[model samples]
Target: MKKVLVTGASGQLGKCFQKIASEYPEMELRNFNSSELDITDQNRLQQIFSEENPEYCINCAAYTNVEKAEDDEETAFKINAEAVKNLAEVCKNTGTVLIHISTDYVFDGKATNAYRETDVVNPINVYGASKLKGEEYIRQILDQHFIFRTSWLYSEFGHNFFNTILKKAEEGATLNITTSQTGTPTNANDLADFILQLIREENSEFGLYHYSNLGEATWYDFAKAILEFSGKIDQVTLNKSGYYKTRAERPTYSVLDKQKLQETFKKLVLHWRDSLEDLIINRFRKI
Candidate 1:
């Protein structure tokens, strides 16, 4: 059986992988949360790599707090950039294929058409810049790596827009979300399944690839869908400013073009709404 080591086990994406791990019984997966293994600690990473010697290392760990990243650029870079560099370096030496999770924020969000994998990156905020730096490190230091740039990730097990919207609707609280900001809402399960596909095939098409649900929606549309899908209707208003203000400026458009991924993986990417419905009904409702 193939051995895979997953970092950031407690994260939404990592948990999603854990949820469906049983389906892939041919692989032995060792999932580790931050507590079990801090990516920032190079010595610990080296120790683990030396001990486990996994054939594949899926790095789901990253600093994802966009708003907080503005104030804590150092910590964000440490986890997002420096830690990723550490992992890439270790993976290079150990001959382990490194699959790193990145974000669409790496792009400036200025493109009218969907951003492609080859699009020039210009991160507008600290979070995006940091993630881009991590990507650079992986590309510069390692050849055996898969960097998946995803956006608007949500899952049942973690704190995400999906659960937040459902909770707000249940409480009958009026909510205001940004209408200008647009991106694809990725169900982590879809991404998890795709990741497993690459590993199962021992896919060595190593490079940066964009992966997200098909189609696009604004934040408001996302909220509306969440409410409707959960069978709840609350006053979910669109707010252009004020209450929705953050320290960093968000990209007006960040829908990724998944042509490269879809073609390479030989899979059809589902529409965002369709995937959202499936997740809410089959997974979220059960919980």
Candidate 2:
């Protein structure tokens, strides 16, 4: 069995990996939450790398708060950049292939067309800048690495747009989501499945790639889709707003192109609406 180590096991995407780990019997996954594995602590990371000696190390640990990152730049950089540097170093020494999750926020969101992996990066926020720094560190430190830059990720677990909308609808709260930004609403579970596919196939054609659901949508579109898919459209009033006030400025448009991912992996990428519908109908049927 191929052994894999995952960091930030408590986060949404990390939890996605945990939820689907059992399906892949040929792979053995060892998960570590923040408390269990302090990625910022280099000595602890080295020790764990030495002990586990995993063939793959998936770094899901990141400072993802966009607004809060504006005020807490140091903390964001520490976790997103410095800690990632440490992980890359340890992975390099241990001969472990690093699978890192990055953000589409790395782009300035000005491109009228979908962003290619070769596009120039110009991050607009602290969170994006820090994540870009982490990506740079990985590229510099290790060659056997896969950096997947995805957009608008949400899952069944954790505080995300999908859960927020569902909870608000359950409480009969009127929602006014923004239409300012345009990007794909990627299901974290879909991303998790794709990562496992790479590991299972032992994919060697790895470097930088953009991965997201096939189609793109704005926050307003995403909210509407979630409500409609969950059969909660009549439960609450959903309005489209041109603006949503926030501390950190987001991209006006940040849709990522998945042409490289499709051609490289030769895997069918599901549309965002289909994925969301499936999650609502099958996965969240109990709710």
Off by over 4 Å in 2: none
lDDT of 1 at 2: 89
The TM-score leader among the candidates is 2
RMSD of each: 1.7, 1.0
Judging by lDDT against the true structure, name the best candidate.
2
Lowest-sum lDDT 10-residue window in model 1: 234-243
* Estimated TM-score for each candidate: 0.96, 0.98
lDDT of 1 by residue, 90-180 (tens): 9999999999999999888889999999999999999999999999999999999999999999988778998998878767787877787
Q: What would the per-residue lDDT of candidate 2 be over residues 119-209, giving only the tens digit for each residue?
A: 9999999999999999999999999999999999999999999999999999999899999999999999999999999999999997999
